[model samples]
Target: MVNLGDLNNDIPFDVLSRLPTKYMPKLKCVSKGWNRLISDPTFMKVQSQKREQLSGFFFQQKYQWCYDDITTISYIPVEKQDAELHKTVFNFLPEHVVVLASCNGLLCCRSCFPFHDSCLYICNPLSNEWLRLKWDEPNKENSFALAFDPCQDPIATPTNFKLIRVKQFETDKEALCFSFEIYSSDKGAWRKSEEICKCNNNLYKNRGIFTEGVLHWLTDGDEVLTFNVENELSWLVSVPIPANEFRSIPESCIGDSDGRLHYILVSEYGLQVWFLEDYFESRWSLKLCKTLEEMEEEHSQFLYNLRERVTQRLAVDMEPWIDPLAFKDGPLFCFTIATFHAHFSILEENLCSKFLTSCTQTSSLLHGKAIHAKFIKGSIPHSLYLQNHILNMYVKCGDLINGHKLFDEMPERNVVSWSAMVSGFTQHRFYNEALSLFVYMLRDGTSRPNEFTFVSVLQACSLHESLALAYQVYAVVLRLGFGSNVFLVNAFLTALMRHGEKEEAFEVFEKCLNKDIVTWNVMLSGYLESSCLELPKFWVQMNNEGVKPDCFTFASVLTGLASLGELNMGLQAHGQIVKSGHGGEICVGNSLVDMYIKSQRLFDGLKEKEEMAVQKKQAEVRPVGTLVQF
Candidate 1:
């Protein structure tokens, strides 16, 4: 994207691209020649990606435009070293501006002017990479957000991503869609995302988020739209929002934390959050933060619940550091400043000893046992009796070195120790190291491996792409017993598919009588990603086995069919999809449309797309869908 800039912007893009599209709307605001340039699709795409990256990262209400001396600002999450939160500086110098949205760790900012054209930029403050995107004319009123299109599964990386600015007309009744663009690193041109803007006669805000290859936002009328970068299609979705929230709060923006879509609804008193759950019939659950009036009761409840989690996390009666639930859901990104700093400080305090010493120790280290005796020798067995108290402490304090040291010194090892070691490795992505230890425990008389061990080993094998060892470990599991355990079997399937063994993988799966949805997904992915000779047969087998092919089953099978260019067989599957009512799922519909398009069935593709459109409208327009209110 950086290769060619418009003749106006002194960027390398103009000089680099075979044919550059430049000096569009922003230049058009300057002259008619520039306006003509803005009309081209290529220019729109590049500028949009760039703008999306910079135009929105994170913005707090700088309520007033106070373009005055803004000196010495340290970001909250970063400056305080909040473990779960993110912090980065604004790359551009202390020039005052307001941030709109941030996508893919890039931020966009607007200057102090009320009506004039505001500046746009894509910046990674941590990396100090900044690209300034210019816009044409004044943006007096616009409903937009910064969106990064990292096509998770790319057919091919498009020329660029886009910044979608929903331009409202005189009244809220209509809106026009314009985009600021980014240049694709892989594709050397600007690309366009043909997203349509939704209009309503009510106040709207931009809560656009970059997730799953789309930019999603709740519209002014409380509807949702998702923009797909690969196909450049803007699709409407029915985002769940609570009825009371819209009535109580004037407007809100969208944000994602910990893989869940969240909308921050602020009122006179404080901020409330609605967590959008995509599963369980697409509903939003509300969580209220504690205010002064509610603090005592909430605090009492929190402590009551916290005590239970601590006991579960810690086993023995040692003082609990972090509540066990805090680590549940795999470390939430929600914590106050004081709580986070305390957590970090606790980590540092625990790291002062030999356990800390081992972690930062070079790969070629000496006296492994000597180090263990040096820091935590005598008091450990007592610590172990304390229900893995010290282990939890080590895990929490981020003192894995000490945790491992304590772990190794134990008189007898339990399932938790091995699991912890494996988990630590998995978390850090040292898959081979984790798998080696898992094997060592199973075969080398170090520790007794359990079902959890098998799960961890299979997962590590998947990550390492260790097909040979994965099969061997599968054998070990069968010999050790618990071969038919569904969870372990699912992990085995996942590992096999990851290692590219689909047929034998299915053979292994057939032995596991207890079937679950996850197991089916792994089996299905083999057919989805690669054409195994037996996929059509397996698709039929999955149905015979009383395993209803969900949208995922159809999606994966369709992929294998598409790869083989089996249009006739593909049509047969499509007929099954219709009979099975799988066409209603958004995921299945998307895959179906793509398959149809590839098979030169535009009519079918359009028909599936229309179903998605209908689903979106029905979900978003009105929960009850009636013109009159009782």
Candidate 2:
């Protein structure tokens, strides 16, 4: 194999730039030269430009009936090539991010759980490069828009970007008005923009279109709201067509297409597309007009072509109505269709799988249910992998009713499917249910219990304090030749110890050849809790085995020694903790303080307590503007 660095830098640059951005992070390990090449900000920008494409529209739908305002944001890709791109687009971000705005491939996102002051982050999902904005006024509810134009100079290192925050305030006359706060990347701080645009009509807060260094938003009134980022000025232009008298509200939106502004209007008859021919003259020209029948016919043809390529049949029960969302380059238009039951999207099987995994990881029940509904409506064949993922999502999200329902409805079951449900039941404290499912899994004879399956069942037994059930499970484990398996032995030992069968737990521990830190900790904790006199002997044996003690071990030993008023043993444990580098841990410190106090060393205990308090204070006073690189 040839080294990437051995060739000219341009050769490697061209090859690496063409690869997908998701795979770029892993390529850093190829060589130091490759790492440096990929780390360059200029190379990342070029790669982002090549790999990032406007494939979809992300829209938020609000469910008013929910007690808390629940907004479901989803993406619908326009082209087939970008169908799977949405799965990993925002996965690199640390927290759940609500996409506030998008401009030139950079997404302005705010943390879903804004527990801190700096919740806003401007990120390029393609390259996984992000910058957190210093947001001091987190308490104030403000609408934000992003404006990013790539640097024109070839030698420029940093890209220049701007963020516009609009806050609504009440005037002395009790009329609503908006004020502007602008943050520029070059200045690295936020400044108040003197210009303020006042409008009584409620502006669409979430949606903003950025083009030609200007951001636009549609207002309730028949006007277009505009903000120029460079000059920090706000203005309004009259709409091409005013709201009709009969219709109290009109379905209209604004978008940028090929560097020019375009307006779309939906009426009972059909849809009309208008282009802003001249911004200075405020001139408008009708670009395209279509009747409702014509639009439906085109949609039907598109769906028909899609159906031909798909082997599965489409659902015939639901009627979906489409709403045009935005216009892209050429004839590409992004739209969203909603049925009576759920929103519809043509998600590929793998994409559905990824969405289910994300939902499971986040415990997002609502999103999981929506994806399941879409899967059913799309009539995709349920592979065992997808079915297991869906089941796991439901179970992990604590929706056991739906999880069991889906499990029962599944045509086939595998060991993974059984293990997930069993684990879910045990995790949610449904001990009896978990045991019953384990028994049923055995009776079904389709799948056999693996180590993971046994782990959950043993945990359920231990938590339920069912020694008889644990014995039976252990017999099965022995028969399956897993008696020496360290994990199974540990679980077995835990069950025995929890039921006060220390002798049996010790016997199991002695027979196991491979023991990890957890095994030692489990035995040591059980002995300490039961006041077993063999604790000292066991600790010496652990040291003889060359197994290092961690914070938990030191804490347990210190607590036991303190209870018995053994100051010498406690002091020895403290020295071990210090040598092991666990003395600074909060748990270890608390243990040491307790041990010192119980031994009548009042001065030492108070000194340790004061040290802990000072350390915590210093941690709390640390600066918050530290840059976090992903």
Candidate 3:
């Protein structure tokens, strides 16, 4: 055995003495002295020089940024009026540079090049060591954007950062193409990939955002494209688009939903995002957001600009979203890389809870139309937002089933009071009840349906197909200037189609400016129902617009064609189906047989295909490898 005297000072820990305690018992007998050193709480604690080994020490607050200046005008949610937070300013930033986010217990900051110089530096906050990220080729008139996710795992050998830097060189200045790359400290390398972009669209006037676990940016045609940090891959998808602009500028193009690679597109629409159900697939189906225009039109207040005020008012109720259980368990929750471990009661959640409780209780306690006026009489209680939160919870819980009694008994019924009723019915699937309240809301005509109000009404009408009712809704929808909303147009079209008013449905379909695949499907189905047999031509239109048809589109068209008794066309479609490897899809195959049978093309052919499908399904479920081996 090596003597402890021979050990160097740099290796400070007692490796030999601790070795037996850490890894012995398998080799030989251990004495009580060695056992005590390993088992003694104080010795073990001092031996491992890591900070905060216990989980319940500190709580973290989350902040979101949407603009260019990281220095001035940063907005963070304050848990309380007296709540305080620390800010670490990186003065080492070269002039125009700024920091984006702190991820994985490490800090990431980016410095922009001055006057289109195109040179940029990205750094790790913990190391103070930065990299002069090399562009594939340099350009003087070029511009750059950068992001850093600092979260790291101390227990692991090394940590990971979501490092993405994009450089766009002006073609006029001398560049054939645009290039971007993501960096990984764990692998100690960078990989090259191209974003999903339109080859013939504008690349210079580009916008970028960094959040979750990737760098997200919008393309010319308004597609949301992202570069993944962990897998080093890129992806593109269509997100929800709002009809009207915030200040006539599209708010959909703002940034990534929440940075840790989570898709915030639905949340951006102002929906009550329940659970990120399947965040990995980037599949987000939210409790629909009622946009500002939908709200305005619903209450016959179609001619107003209430989006900003309504948004501000709606935001107050959701503040401080931390879990309440955290308060009793831990001193603080650590949030790194956008994931929280150990729960710290966020001051914000408490604030949000109080806001909800206050909005309702004060209304119960006061009798005037203006609750604000009463608060004005005295200092506005700290409990106002909490009262509003309680009202919202009551509404969501459908406790508003007793709302009529509650409203009559209420000290006052202001806008929020009516809103609570409208929201309550909608949340509880009391659509007719919700609609009745809308009529009542407009009876006196003082209160108007704001953004949140209208979206609920429009969604309620989507499944109910009453053309006259929809047209009336449309008159208001357009009067509120929501004619541009792709989603609402869907509701408008569905109403017409159900009433067999194919002509009117087609009119609105053609007028939509932002046509995604869903829009195309609606139009294609309408054209087919009207026997405008040239359905495939619309696929050309979709292709020309650069919208890719998924397998669902194929299923929709094939079902339509089979219904038309077009055997030759069906045969051609079958060829396309087989070519696209969708021949065996259940809907496609079933529709193919149904089409053939209806067309009287060949009855035997249909039966044989069904048998083959059944055989295939059976084969898929019963593995051949499971059979006994000789």
Candidate 4:
């Protein structure tokens, strides 16, 4: 047997690069040589090129409420493996982080706190590393776009990244002038560019697309704002389509495919895809055009009652609207249909499993129902995986009645089907039903409970206040080799704490090998909720472990301090909160106010309250059109 050491380094390098990126970290532990090979910049670039094609797209949707608007970023993948890998790409970031833009494998995120100074973070989810940008001018409502091309630099470094911030300024003549402030990782600071572009129409602040060393933003007029990152020049290119054909709200978007710029136009007629055949010559080529009737005929089952639903909303004057989102390398396009309710749909050759999963993830009940109707009519092929997705969609959309009926009618049940139903029941407060389903699943022996199944069942046990059942489930979890799942362990700890089993919960916590921030928060909050005098001791232990506290942790600790009237400790905690950049979190702010008021610092408390009120009013008054609401 020849040792790897005897083989050429290229042999090992080529073999390792073929493995999934998720396993790279573990492979680094094999030896120092392997670690160095994997850590090399060149090796990373090669591996990235060898990796799979563009897996999916991350899109943001804003939901407007009476007081404020909440923006959420969601990922939809084209393949199941990609879904499992990239769905939680941003979960590792702090809560309330809004993704500003993405290029290559990097994401630019901003803190979404209304009152505090905004912070920007550039992170690589695959590598689980992030860097915070120095952004002092948080009050400026400027647009930002990220540009990074892996092929540009052989030796990749942070300096290879560029962030462009566009701020609109008015001249004495009242013309709309936009200035560019660029942040280069190499320079380690932001510099003002002398290039200024004047336009008659406003550019969409958040909708910037970077492709081929050029950053493009769609303008309110019939032009696109193109900025060359290398030359630091700005110009506008006329949209390929006629100006009058565009809608007032601008349903068209610019996307990049195969290193060429493509413009997507959404109109009452249908969707048109135009490619820039020659950027220099300003030549455009019509690649694909589908009429509304053609689209409806092709996706009739999916858009079954879309027109009827829009008619019911009395938007008879308004035609069915489609918003172009993202365009991939091939013919695939991602977009949303608005028929009173927004439904996400992918225009692909076939309604694949990934599309069904996307609908389930977005809770698009109407689309899911249409697909199910197609399944019933034998128009679409039936599979256990697709059926489970539909069931999950109904359950997530709060149609539990339909969800249960579908579950019962399923020709066969798998682990996913059972787990989805169980989670649904628990989520909708049917704890008894969840417990019953768990028992039935075990008795049937068709499938065994996995980590997810245990999590949901444990939650049900805790909410049902059935400690005995929780203990039984815990035993089964351990026997089934799922004793190491952190999520399952967290749920078990919660169950124990809810029943006043503090000592037992502590034991479980200590036994947990991998304690994430969530684990520590659970223990801290549990102690506070129990009014246990050991709260301070537990807090000290958590600090000793060097677990960074988040907004939730700060909120819990401050609440306990307030109840105990520990003003001095509360002050120190408040300083830490600010230092950690969680000062803008509404939960933390509210807790700060509570602590100050409880400690008789009425002036400070009142000041915080007033500031929060002002911020709330600002958010409420902001124009809805400026927001990217679904």
Question: Top model by TM-score, which number?
Answer: 2
Candidate 2: clashing pairs of residues: none
Q: In what order do the candidates fall by TM-score, top score first?
A: 2, 4, 1, 3
Q: How accurate is candidate 4 locally (lDDT)?
A: 0.73
Clashing pairs in 4: 159-186
TM-score of each: 0.39, 0.54, 0.35, 0.49
**How do the residues 478-510 of candidate 4 rate in per-residue lDDT, one tens digit apiece?**
998899999999999999888889999999999
Displacement of residue 175 (Cα, Å) in model 2 is 32
What are the Cα lDDT values of the candidates? Answer: 0.54, 0.72, 0.48, 0.73
lDDT tens digits by residue: candidate 3, 1-630: 876644542242365334423343332235555444444445444433332221111222222234333232111212322222223323445554443333333344334332334344555443455655444454433333344432222212234454555554446635333456666555666775555322223332343555555555555544455565555566554444433433232323333233323222212234233223333464545533565466346422211333543343322222122232233211111111012210111223342343334324322211111222323344234343434444565565446644455555555456676777676777778788777787788795766665556656665565444446657777887888877877777766766665667767777778888767777777776666676565766655665776766566776776777776656766776777777777666766766777777777677456748765785777683312111100
**Model 3 per-residue lDDT at 502:** 73
What lDDT, from 0 to 1, does candidate 3 have? 0.48
Candidate 3: count of backbone clashes, pairs at least 3 residues apart or interchain? 43
Report the number of backbone clashes for model 1.
40
Residue-wise lDDT of candidate 1 within 1-630, one digit each (tens)?
Answer: 554444454333353222322333234476554444544455455454332211111213122224432222224222122232222355353445556656655566655453455566655555556655555564635445655543331112322445656544343444544343444544534444445444443334444676656667666655565566556666455545543553233334666654567665433233356777663255677755433234224444222233332223322111111222232221121222112222221222232232323222312112222223333534233333332444544544355676677667777777767777776676667787787778667665756788877787888888887878878888888898888799888888888777677767878777778788778888878666665566777767777777767788788888777766777877888888889987777777777788889988899889889988998777673322111100
Better of 1 and 4 by TM-score: 4
Q: Mark the 10 consecutive residues where model 2 has the least summed lDDT.
A: 328-337
